[model samples]
Structures are given as structure tokens and as C-alpha cells.
Target: MNQYLISIYQPDGPTPEPEILEPIMRDVEAVNAELREAGAWVFAGGLFPPSTSTVLRLKDSEVLTTDGPYVEGKEHLGGFTVIRAADLDEALAWGEKVARAITLPVEVRPLQHGACQ
Candidate 1:
């Protein structure tokens, strides 16, 4: 089986208020349950915003750590799901469900290797 990553993208901005957030989270939970029942779920979860990120680099044999993502961009990964499927088509099917649940664009890609990556 090929492992694929189904990433949910949220444009940079203030997060939605709970009134908006709660329903989406519920929908996402429903999708997660369906994936679990279908055995298509490996793992999935939400993430903190980009502001909390820390980057570490090696310079002159010393570790240099910085705040923020590797690169500055308007978009950062909002959340992700990892699943094992027979092929890209199967993986994309999963992505479709996720996209619908979150009402956002989902970026799907096959991992180079299963588990090791």
C-alpha cells in the first residue's frame, strides 16, 4: 500500500470564531470516524497556527534555532491526515471527503515510502 498525505490548507489570517469553528470541527470528526470505519485512517489532527512554530538550523557546528516556519508564506499547513491506500485514486477519494468536511482545498500527495517517511 502507498501512504499518502492529505493536507488541509487555510489561508493566513485570524482563525474563525468558535461559532464558525465548532461546526467545522464536528464535520471533521465525522469524516475521521468514517475513515476509521473504512480502515482508510492512519492518523489525523489539527495544528496550532504558524506563530507558534520554531525552526532549527545548524551553523558552524552549533544549532541555531529561530521562530517561524522554514519560509515566510501567506499560507501555512493548517492540518493533515496520513493514510495508506492502494493507489493515488484511492488516496484522492479520501482527500475529497476531507475537503468537503472542512470546506477547504486539500493538497494530496503520495509519500515516497510507507512508514519511513
Candidate 2:
């Protein structure tokens, strides 16, 4: 099996009200359940807001630290999942489900090395 990273991006906008939010949350949970059942789920999680992020860089062997993300943007990574699949096609199929659940684009990319395969 190959491992892929599915990145979830969220736009900079107001949070959805619960009446509209609950169903989406359920959809995502259903997908997670499917992944778990398929043995594709390695791990996944929602992230804290970007403002809570810390950036670090290496300069002349010194560790430089800064607040916020490496790039400021209207959208940020809201969460991600690492899944194991037989191939890119399989990974992309999973990506489609996540996109529908999150109502956002999902980036699907293969891991260069597979430690869990």
C-alpha cells in the first residue's frame, strides 16, 4: 500500500452556524468511519486556527522562530489525513469523498516513502 496525504483547506470566513454545520460534521465523520473500516485510516485531525501557529526557519545554523504561518493567505490548512491506498487512483477517490464532506478542496499527494506499507 502507498500512503497519501489529504490536505483540507479552509477559507478565511465566518464559521457556519450550527444548524448548517451539524450535517457537514456528520458527513465528515461518516467518511472517517469509512476510512477506518477500509483500513485506510492512519490518522487525521482538525487543526487550531492559523493564528495559533508558529513558524521556524534555519538561518546560518540558527533556529529562527516567528508567529503565524510560513505564508499568510486567505485560506489555510484546516486539517489533514494520512491514508493508505493501493494507488493514486484509490487515493484520489478518497480525496473526492473528503472534499464533499468538508465542502472544500482536498490536496492528495503520495508520500515518497512508505513506512507503514
Candidate 3:
């Protein structure tokens, strides 16, 4: 089975209200449980706020670090799940579940072979 990364993205920052977020959190938990039961779950997690990010780069043996994301954009990765699936279609099917549960955009991408190991 190929490994896929299912990433959540939000353009306006994280959900604003606990009332709205609570249900989504429950749905996310359910999805994770289902994935684990099905043996498809590799890893899953939510991210800290974008303000906590730090970007680093190395050039000519010099290390440079910055206080924010690599690119300035409205959308940022909010969370992700890694899963093993038979193919792209299967991966996307999992991604659809994530998107529906969180009511957010989900991006699914195949991991390079052997990358997971």
C-alpha cells in the first residue's frame, strides 16, 4: 500500500468558536478511530497556531531562521493524517472523509516510495 498525506487547510485561521469546533473535533476523532480500526492510520495530529511556526534555511553552511512560515499566504496547514492505501483513489476517499468531518479543504498527496520508512 502507498502512503498518503491528508492535510487540512484553512484560509481564515482555525475555527473561531468552540461551539462550532467541538462537533468537528468529535468527527475528527471518529475518523481517526475508524482509520486505526481499519489499519490505515499511520499518524495523525493537529498543528499549533501559525504564530508558533519558525522557518529555517541553510545556505553555504550558514543557517538562517525566521519567525514565520516560509511563504506569506492566507491559507496554512492546520493538521494532517498519514494513511496507507492501495492507490490514489483510496487515499482520496479517506481525504474526503476528513474534509467532510472538519468542513475544511483537504489536500491528499502520495508520499514518495520508501519515504515513510
Tens digit of lDDT per residue, candidate 1, span 10-115?
Answer: 8899988999989988998998999899888889777899889999999999999999888888888999999878999999888998999998889999888735
How does each model score on lDDT?
0.89, 0.93, 0.91
Error of 1 at 32 (Å): 0.6
Predicted candidate 3: what Cα RMSD to the true structure? 1.3
Clash number for candidate 1: 0
Stretch of 10 with least lDDT, candidate 2: 108-117
Error of 3 at 55 (Å): 0.9
Candidate 3: residue 57 Cα off by (Å): 1.2
Q: TM-score of each candidate? A: 0.88, 0.94, 0.93
CA error at residue 1 for candidate 3, angstroms:
1.1
Better of 1 and 3 by TM-score: 3
Candidate 1 lDDT at 4 equals 91
User: What is the lDDT for 80 in model 1?
Assistant: 95
